[model samples]
Target chain A: MRDAFHEDLDKISDSLVEMTRLVGSAMSRATTALLDSDLGLAEGVIENDVQIDAIRDDIDEMAVQLIAQQQPVATDLRIVVTALHMASSLERMGDLAEHVAKVARLRYPHKAVPPQANATIVEMAQIAERLVAQAGSIIAAKDVDGAEALHADDDEMDRLHRDMFVLLVDEGWEGGTESAIDVTLLARYFERFADHAVSVARQVAYLVTGEWEHKRRVGAPA
Target chain B: MRDAFHEDLDKISDSLVEMTRLVGSAMSRATTALLDSDLGLAEGVIENDVQIDAIRDDIDEMAVQLIAQQQPVATDLRIVVTALHMASSLERMGDLAEHVAKVARLRYPHKAVPPQANATIVEMAQIAERLVAQAGSIIAAKDVDGAEALHADDDEMDRLHRDMFVLLVDEGWEGGTESAIDVTLLARYFERFADHAVSVARQVAYLVTGEWEHKRRVGAPA
Candidate 1:
């Protein structure tokens, strides 16, 4: 019974890691869709979210069953619970990606702001996507050190977020009302996506270290 | 041994509910501070955050100990895992309230936008606070029906958020760039606060039903 439970648990973790990969790809594609104003790609992301949700449900069911049947103890229990939390975070990341795609669909054909403003957004997106990917890798490898490194990526995204805000304000001052509003919304979306990625990294850190990192003060690096 | 473990679990759940109350009050006070431009209240919210974080840590440690020592089975295990998820969500809710307070501090003494816009924000804040408070009540009472009722409150928040966006854009066309930017950031903060409240509600639902709620579609009523 115990061995069978272990196999079931492993399968659940495998599904969670797969879901994380899908979400990471969805986010990367969403960013590309935004930059290129490709409504088709955005629509594809929106449509693919059902699969992510289905995986989340399957994991939850498996985890609950494991606890009910095998009655996990200590590290095994932590592993199951962590998988559930990670699944939720991954699903939220997917939702944020879909939100980005929706914005792309809404404001297509016209760049939200000047090309320079978008450059910062693109940079933040890259960092966020990489963080998500690295988080999945760390979970798969159970590498505490690799999970810790994800915070630096979050710091980079934070710096880019601040720069985006400053640029938006400067553009507003320079009489770019329409473009500035678009830029502000776009920047906010990317900042939120980064926040969710930080959330994923924090969960991974918790799973490995059993410690929750402090929420970094805005001015400081994570 | 089992009786002692159950008693300890009860105590931990009580503490989790208490922490939820602290976070809900923090959010309410922060919103009022924003609307009144009361720096003292905003500062008070920031200062009280230490207590919230301390409660979070205490609950986390207790949960970990319960899982390690008690080795709870099935429903009991779910309770422990749920507590961990709840603590994390409450911590994030506190951070969101702090973010709102920071905005209050930044735009202090000079009402960044008009009173009308401020009123809308205050409404959003009130709804968010109520939803969080209800989440705490549901957890404390174990009332699934109460949680379901609060579920619809997120829809109200969504509608108000859309209205705020429209107001911001329209104001940009009429009230000039500065007001538009202020409204834009303010909208983002309120929208995020609502999102956190939705998260709290989802956690409550999970605790009651042992399942995840689907992500509410953007622009759809709750």
Candidate 2:
């Protein structure tokens, strides 16, 4: 019986890792769709997000069932709860990718991101893809060290985000208000994508370390 | 023992409703601070968010304990899990309110919304406050009809968001790119706030009705 429970636990981990892979692909494809104005690719990414949601729903359902039936305690319980949390973060990551795709679809042939900010947006998308892929490995291997290292990727994404803002708000900038709005929101989507990746890594860290890394500064208005 | 478990479940519901109230107040105060440039009020909202987080942490801890100890089944297990989901959504609502406060602080001594957009932003904030307060009653009473009514409020918010976009992008508008960026992001923050509120209402509807609402569109981007 205990073996069966452990097996179920392993399945949950597998499901989360699977979610990460799907999310990573979604981000990568969504970026391509945005850059190339490829409506078909953008539509595909949006369509696949449902698969990510289904996996999340499955993991959540399975975790809840395991808790009710197996009556896990201590670390076992923590693992199940953390899996649920990770599933949620992963699903949000997928949704962020969908949001990016939606922007691409909204702009169609015009391209949501302008040429001036294109390189930076591409880099941000690459970072988001890499970070989520790494997040998957961290969950699969339960590597606390790998989870901690995700912070660097998050920092890089943040740097790109800040640079994008600076560029858009520069005095000599010529992107017009509409393009500025698009780039600003697009940068935020990528930044938030990385944030969710870090959040998932933090959950993985907690699952392995049994101690939360940080309390997120309770009064932080932002 | 079963009766005790049921009582604990009631307590979880109460905690969620309490969280809703805190979030509602935070949004209201943050809006005032943004529109009025009231630094003290903004800071106060930021500070109070900690209380919301503590309540969420408590709900999470209690729900986990109940699941572990009682090993609840069927609807009992569903109720516990839904409470956790609701607590998470409410906590995120608080964080969104904090984000609004942070923006207000960042722009202190200067208004975040321009004179033209101020009234619309204020209206959005009011709708958010009303929706969340109604959400509190929905949770407390498990009022499915009230939860259903939240959709109209969310629709109003979406309409405002769309109109704000049009206003910002119109050729005659003169808010400048920086101000345009601020208003755009502010509008998005409020739109997302409403989205989260609707999500919470959907969760409540699920708890009472046991049917997920429309699966949120599987494809077509956005």
Q: What docking grade does candidate 1 earn?
A: acceptable
Query: If chain B of candidate 1 is superposed on the true chain B, what is its TM-score?
Result: 0.84
- List residue ranges in candidate 1 displaced over 4 A: A1-13, A68-72, A109-116, A171-179, A202-206, A209-222, B1-9, B66-72, B171-179, B195-206, B209-222
Q: Please give the range of 10 consecutive residues that has the lowest summed lDDT in model 2 chain A.
A: A213-222
lDDT of 2: 0.80
Candidate 2 regions with alpha-carbon error over 4 angstroms: A209-222, B209-222
Residue B80 miss distance in model 1 (angstroms):
4.2
**lDDT tens digits, residue span A1-222, model 2:** 447778888889899999999999999999999999999999999888889988877886787677777777766676676677778778888988998999999999888888899999999999999988988988889887676687678888989998988898898777888899989889988988888887787677666654532423211112
**lDDT per residue as tens, model 1, A1-222:** 448766886688678679778988988888888888898998999899878877876776687677767765656666566667677667777877887788787778754446766678788788877877777776677665565576677778778877866776664445266666666766666666666655655555545544444322221110
User: For residue A146, what is the lDDT in candidate 1?
Assistant: 68
Docking quality (DockQ) for each candidate: 0.34, 0.56
User: lDDT tens digits, residues B1-222, model 2?
Assistant: 448787787788888888988999899888889899999999999898889888977886788787777777756676676677777778888988888888899889998778988878988998888888888888888886676777688889999999999999998777788788888888887887777777776677656654433323311112
lDDT of 1 at B176: 57
